[model samples]
Structures are given as C-alpha cells and as structure tokens.
Target chain A: MTSAAQLTQAQDRFIAVWGQMAGAWGVSRTMAEVHALLYITGEPLCTDDVMERLQISRGNASMSLRALLDWAIIERAHKRGDRKEYFHAEQDVWTLFRAIVRQRITREVDPLLASLYEIRDMTAIDRKRARSDNEDLRERIDIHNQRLESMLEFFQTLEQLAAMFISPAGKGLQAAATLLSKSPREEAAP
Target chain B: MTSAAQLTQAQDRFIAVWGQMAGAWGVSRTMAEVHALLYITGEPLCTDDVMERLQISRGNASMSLRALLDWAIIERAHKRGDRKEYFHAEQDVWTLFRAIVRQRITREVDPLLASLYEIRDMTAIDRKRARSDNEDLRERIDIHNQRLESMLEFFQTLEQLAAMFISPAGKGLQAAATLLSKSPREEAAP
Candidate 1:
C-alpha cells in the first residue's frame, strides 16, 4: 500500500507533466496522465488499479482505456494467477507507435477513402450543375483527399514495417522521403 | 486568389474531413481543418479566409490560428507584395510533421528533465531517503524521465537528418537505424 501523500505527489507530478504533453500532442491532460499511469505501472493492471492510482472513476477508466486501445498503445493482458483482465503498455515505444500509426490509418485514412468514393460517385449532372458551386467544392476535396490518402496509406505501412524493424536500414527512412510522412533529414539530424 | 465557389468548396470539404480526422487523431476539428486549408492553399491566407470559408467568428479564427501556430503547423507569412501578414502552412506535409514532432519533444520531454532534477535535489529527509516511498517514486520517475529524454533526443536528431533526405538511398535508411532511433528488437523478427 502506498501512502496517500506519496500517491498524491506522484499523481500531481504526472498531471503537471502530462498537461504540457497533452496540449503539445492534442491529447487531453486526463487522457495522457491516465495513459502515463498505465505505461509506468510496470505490470498489467486491472480497472481497479487505474481507478485507485489515478483517482478516477471506473467509467472514466473504461472510456480512456478504450481510447488508448483505439490508439493501440495499451493491450490486454491476463496475469498467471489472476482471472480479471488487465492492460499494459507496449514498452517498446516504436511498437507502441506502430500500433497507433496503423490504427490511425484504418480509422482516419480508410474513412476518408470511403468519403472520397461517395462524393466521387455523385453522378447527377442536373444536381451537379445546380450545385456546381458544391460540385466545384466536392471536386477539389476529391483531389486533395486522394493525395492525403495515398500519402497516409504509405506512411501507415512503413510504420508497421518499422515496428517490425524489417526491410531494414535506410529503406524505412527513405520510405519517409519518397512517400513517407516526416523528413529523412529530420530523422538524421537528431 | 481563388474564386468564391472554389473557396467555399475547399472550406466545406476541409471542415467535414477535419471533424473526422480530429476524432482519429487527438487534434480538434477546427485545428485539423485549419491545417488542411493551409496545406492546399497555393498562397498565404489571412484570418478573413479562415472565417469566410468555415463561417467561424473572427475571434474563433484568431484563437484557432494561434493554436495552429503554437503547434507549428501554420506560420505567419509576409509576402513581398502584401503588407497584410498572411498565414501559410509549411506545405511539405512531412516537413510539417517533423516540426510538430520537434516542438512536442521540446514541450513534453524537456520539462520532465527539469522536474526530475528538482526531485533529485529534494532536501527533505522524507524526500531524500531512497528506501522511503517518496524517494522510490522519485527515482522511478527519474529513470523514466531519462529514458524518455534520451529517446526523444535521439529521434529528434534522426528526424532532422531524415528531413534533409541528403542520405543517398544506397546507404541511407540502412544507416538510419543505428544512427537513428534504435529499436530494441535485437533478434531479427523471423
């Protein structure tokens, strides 16, 4: 059992650190802190552990964990002696990053693709003429949407490959340049 | 300068996509769409375009622009012909991503270092005793902080080099793994 003082101190420290992190990355403070808690728990923890450690509600824990699961950061784990389901972070940050990249592609890029197809298939010329204004709008969207989707698909695959550390070396990084997201130059600089 | 129809289309398309995009990523709908607009606009735009296209308030446009500027996705532009400081995206999406990654490293990772140092310098016996729970917590935080800092520093440099795309394909991505972010997967995944 940890002291109330010590636990609160740790929670405060995490909350402070995570606030800056949340704003920077677009994640919320509570979400980042909750993720940070599970990330550092050092073992798979149940809903109770999350609630106790972070002092959040069970419903909130479920929501945030589901969110993280969507990000693919935390995954399910069942300890040897325990029946309750637990969750832990993928410690290899790259692997964790890969899961997120992949999930984001599926959730973000795929839906964009669906939206593009739907708009592109709009064939009523009378409607198009009547809404040429809207048609013009849709056309530009189709153009840019295709571009982003093409780029994002490539990026997601490379991230998966990178997590595997496969196809090796500069190939993964070069993937960044020709079709990948982010610059190879930036990767090399730091 | 774009036509009213063209701008409307661009604005509508982006606003719709941004909402979906924001949900997948941690960013807000307005923030994502704002970035999207900046990405495709051939020339720099001012707050007016942002408001006109999205039908947002002047204050809302200003606030969102400030947020994007903070995120490093959008920048204030000063063209030779124009006195009004227009805003523009970095254009290269990958380059933009690199800048965001770097900024996040500075905001999120750098501050943690300061906190750990302060925790280390804690003078209270309660704070200093290694066996004490507080000290144990502090020490754990320190180690995590160090690992994160080192990782962020390494990746930040790697991203810089990768951004340049200077490394020739023959030896580039191959060289990036050791020279870039080192994934801990020692054994090649079979």
Candidate 2:
C-alpha cells in the first residue's frame, strides 16, 4: 500500500507543478497553489486547511481564495454541520480554461481593441492633416496608418475567433483536431 | 498636420496600454514597452534611443531588449558604417504572435506535458501498490489517477491543436473563422 507519507508527497508535487504552470500564465503562484490543493484533494477545504497544507500565511490564503473566487474558478462551500467556510475548485479543466479565457478577453483584449480603434481613427485624421504639410511626414503617417489598420484587423479577427471558440456549439478544439487529422498537406499538394 | 508633441503623446499612451496587456500575459512591462516602441516606429532603434524614449535605465533597456530578442519577436540589426546594434520588432502582427506562441509552447507547454506524464505514472504505481493493502487508499489513489489522466488528455489535445494551427498551410485563424461561421448548431440539429 502507498503510505500516507507517499500520498502527501504526491499531492505536494502536483500542487507545486500546478503553481508553476499558473505562474507561467501570469497567475499568482499562491492563487494557483490554492487552486491546485483544492483540485488535487477533490474536496472542500477551509482557509486554515489551505494554510496548513501550503505553509502559507492566513492573509495570503484568504487573498488567494478571494482571487480564485473572483476568477470564478473556485467557490465557497459549506460543510454539513460545520461553521468554517470551505472552498472547491471547478474540476473540469476545459471549463476552467474557458473561464480564464473569457475573463482575459473581457479584461485585456476588449480594452486593447477599443484603444486600437481609437488610435486608428486618430491617425487617420492626422494623416489627412499631414497630406498638404510635408511629403516626408505625410508618407510616414501613411505607413503608420497602414500598419495600424492591419494590426486592428488582426485583433478584430482574433477576438471573433475567441468568441467562436467559447460559443456553446463551438466544439472548437474537437473540430480543429478532426480537421488536422484529415491531412491538409495532401489537399494542398495540388 | 499632427504636431510632433501629439505624435509622442499617442505613442506613449499606446506603449502604456501595451505594457499592461503584456503584464496580464506574464511578460514584463518594460519588455512589452520596448516591443511596442519598435512596433510603432516601424524602424530599428538603438539602446540609447530606447532608454531615452522610455525613460528607463540602461540596464533595464538592455535586459528588456535581450529578452525580446530571445522571444524572437524582435531582432538585432546593424546600420551601415555604424557599430551600434539596433533592434526592430517583427512588424507583422501575425508573425509576431506566431513567434510568441511558438516560444511559449516550447518553453512552457512541453515541460508541463512531460511532468504531468511522470506524475500520472507515479500515481498509477502507487494505486497498484495500495490495491492489495488498503481498499480506501487504493480508491483515493484511483480517483486521483483518473483526474490526472483527464488533465493529461486535455493538455495533449491542446498541444495537438496548437501544432496543427502552427503547421505549414494551416491558415489557422482564417480556417477557425470559417468553421465557426458555418453554424455548427444548425448542422447538429435533427
């Protein structure tokens, strides 16, 4: 039988790896560690439990839990006849990924897209003004405007693609896999 | 014509926004700012230019530039009869994204997949050891192993999809858009 020590070791390793993965993706290590603990335990754990298991401070545990809650990847749970609030992670990896992706699109991509549109509009107006001033400056603005337009198109397309992937009937990953399995190279050979 | 002051203001705003976006994605603000500067200028810039324009220390600029170069989104260039090394961004947004994605897949996803596989194997061995000694321990290990397998499958599928998208003739973005536009719901309806 696997000893209790072995079990603890395995859990610790998993949490550490998960924490590193989250760090690479721009998430706080503590937040990722908290989620990893909950996920590996497959049970609701209180902040005290998290603190004990991860060797983190009370405030750190509390903040990590709150951040996870904000990300919608973890939830507060009430144990039967227990006063301490516990937490559990959304076990489905795909759903968790979708939530993160959705949040990033709204928080980061949307703002960038809006800014790009504004910049493009402003540059276009400036381009018009520069046309009759100096040929060199006008040409420079023209190139810049073209690049901005291309960049805007790229982001717009990317946003549309992300939305489609996250749609209910998307099955995007599955569909892409199927398409890839069909061998595009042979079709393109002609 | 738009005055130089206005142009500088717009560039500064764009760089600031770009830095924030990069931070969300786990890149340093300075690295993103440097790339943004080069991207906007559409021209190569030396270390001094980047330092002066961004108001960053020489060491900070050098480090950020080196990091960007490592990511392959920027390249070092030399001016004729000049010893100073200038850097330029990829300029093409699609190409820039491809470079970033490629680097991430190599540096992050590949290592993660390897570790998950190792963890799964270790858990499986432990599950076997527990089966004859303790039923409860075995069951718990089994559940953990199952979760690990599911997680592994999820990552494998993601890696496969990433590979296909990055393959030659993939036209990944356009292809995804086309697939999404076809209305999978209607196709699935009886």
Candidate 3:
C-alpha cells in the first residue's frame, strides 16, 4: 500500500484507540476523536476541517473544540490572513497529561476530599457524645473513624503525589517513577 | 440525635460518596456501594446483609459481590454452621489499591498496549517502503511514529510504576511516595 494510505490507516487507528479510551474514562468519544485529529496532524484545524475530516456534524465539531479548549488541551489559533478561527492541541505529552490530571482533580477529587473532611468532622461530634455514656457506641465510632482516616490518608497521599507531578518546576513524577522502579532499600542506601 | 442514628447517617454518607466515585470512574455505583458497605463495616457480610443494609435488590447485591470477587478486591467466606456465603473487602489500604491497579492493568492497559504494539509494527513496514520513494509521506510517517512512541512510553512508564506498587515484596510505592514528597535534589544528596 502507498505511504499516504498507510499513514491514514494508522492515524484512524490511533484516533479509534483514543476514542475508546475516552469512552472508558467517561468522556465524549467525538471530543477525543477531534482532539486526536488535531494532535496527530499537529496543525491548526478549523471547525469545518474537523467536521469534514471526522465526518462529524459542524455543531459536534464546534462543541468538541470548545470543550477541549476548556480543558486547556487545545488552543485557539489564527492565520495571518484567515478570518476563520483554528484550533490546535497541546502536543507535548507531559503537559497534556498534567492538564488532564489537574482537570480531574478539580472536578472530582477536590469535592470528594471536601465531603470526606466534612463527614469526618460531623462524625467526630457523635464520637464525643458517645464517649460520655455508651461504650459499645464509642467502640463502633472508633472503628468507623479508623476506616475513614485510612481512606482519607490514602486520598490525601494521592492528591499530594498529583500536585508534585503537575508542579511546573518539579520533575517529581519522573524522579518518583525512577525511585519506584529501583529496589526500595538498595536505592535508599545509594 | 442518638449515636446510633448519627453513625448510620455517617455510614450512609460514606457509601453515597463511594458510589458517586464509582460512577465517575466508569464502574457500577451499586457495586461500589456493596464494596463500601463491606469495607466500612470491616466485616464479612452475606448477600442478605448487603441487600438489607444497602436497600438494594438481592440480584444487584449478588451481582456486585460476584464482580468484586472477580476483581479480587473482595473474597468469599463461610461461617461454621452457616450455609450462606459471606463477602469481605481487602481492608488494608495498599492491598486494596494494588488489587484494583492489577485488575485494571489486565483488563484495560494490557489490551491497549497490545494494540499499540501491533499498530506500530504495521506502520513500520509502511515507513520502510516510504523511505525509498516519498519524502513528504515519509516525513508524515516519522511524525506519526514519534507521536506513537511518546504515547507508548508514557503508558509503559505508568505500567511499570503500577507493577512496582503491586509487587508483593516491594515497598516501592511508599518508598517512592516518600522520596517524591521530599525535594528531589535534597533527597538525592542525602
């Protein structure tokens, strides 16, 4: 097969894989496909270009582009003489992953962490009340508190790790990855 | 409110939050609720126990329990003189996370990696043919290869990190977490 045809096939395959991943991750498949097109082509694409290339509706292309922009994974661009706006993906892999991590932490993790803290505090009041009179209730509350604390600690650790990873000046992710890949005690001694 | 009432409310809230997390992570909410119930209670519970506590249908409870077992996050138990099978979650935080990471790697990451390798190999042949004839097409193929390579590398790094974390004898995750929590240069110097 011709190189052009082969390249097209490979691009389509990559887009399909990315779209599947988006579906699994609960994002719009069309939106992921649109991003894939822009990223793979490594060029600015207008909404019409997206629509024609992906065979998606104009509205779908526009909406996908808008959402991608909101995620900060894609940006608006303009050619010197062109009136139509164009979009391009943030092609750097680390930046793209960091953007996704930041967005998810904001959208999902932050609120969950808040709720966890609130629940623990609310339950702490009950524990205090139980402490005065009810031994059985106090024990149960203690167990519950322990469970909640462990979960809270795990999530907090994850949040801290994510923060380190996405920090602009930090190479924490690579450093941590390298550290983890080594034998724990052996690496420590060196 | 009474301590019992407050404790129940807290448990319910915990389960609800876990259920919401499940929905976002593309898992069944009921399944996560069942797991949460077992996990928070820190006890082996039968299907009837799960159903009554979660107010879910027996079928839903049973199905969720089975899936949890399949994921190896929960295991079956039997009480002497009691015929009913009970389920309990892996209570240790690290073990629980390791089980989930292992399951996801098998079901999601492994398949995706296989596809990536196949795509790369298929395009390598086209790249070789393009080398002789088409400069423009060859350049495009090279760009595509580079993109594919970066994605593959990122995923591979993640897989390696996960493997290290889940290794039974490895303190890799905690060690790495501690290492990352410290400034990289300071940690290295020490």
Top TM-score hit: 3
For all predictions, the C-alpha RMSD in Å is: 8.8, 3.7, 3.3
* Candidate 1, residue B94: lDDT: 49
Using all chains and alpha carbons, the TM-scores for the candidates as numbered come to 0.57, 0.89, 0.90
DockQ (model 2, Cα)? 0.45
Chain A only: give the TM-score of model 2. Answer: 0.87
Off by over 4 Å in 3: A24-26, A131-134, A175-190, B131-134, B175-190
Using DockQ as the measure, the top candidate is 3
Q: Which candidate would rank higher by DockQ, 1 or 2?
A: 2
Better of 2 and 3 by lDDT: 3
As a whole number from 0 to 100, the lDDT of residue B39 in candidate 3 is: 88
Off by over 4 Å in 2: A131-133, A172-190, B131-133, B172-190
lDDT of 3 by residue, A35-154 (tens): 898888787999999999889998898899999998999999999999999999988887898888888888888989998998898788777787566798888888888999988877
Instruction: For model 2, state the Cα shift of residue B14 in Å.
Output: 1.2
- Candidate 3, after superposition: displacement of residue A67 in Å? 1.4
Question: Which of the two candidates, 2 or 3, achieves a greater DockQ against the reference?
Answer: 3
Q: Which scores better on lDDT, 1 or 3?
A: 3
Clashing pairs in 2: none
> lDDT per residue, candidate 1, A91-143, as tens digits?
76555544654555565566775664443343212223435556655565554
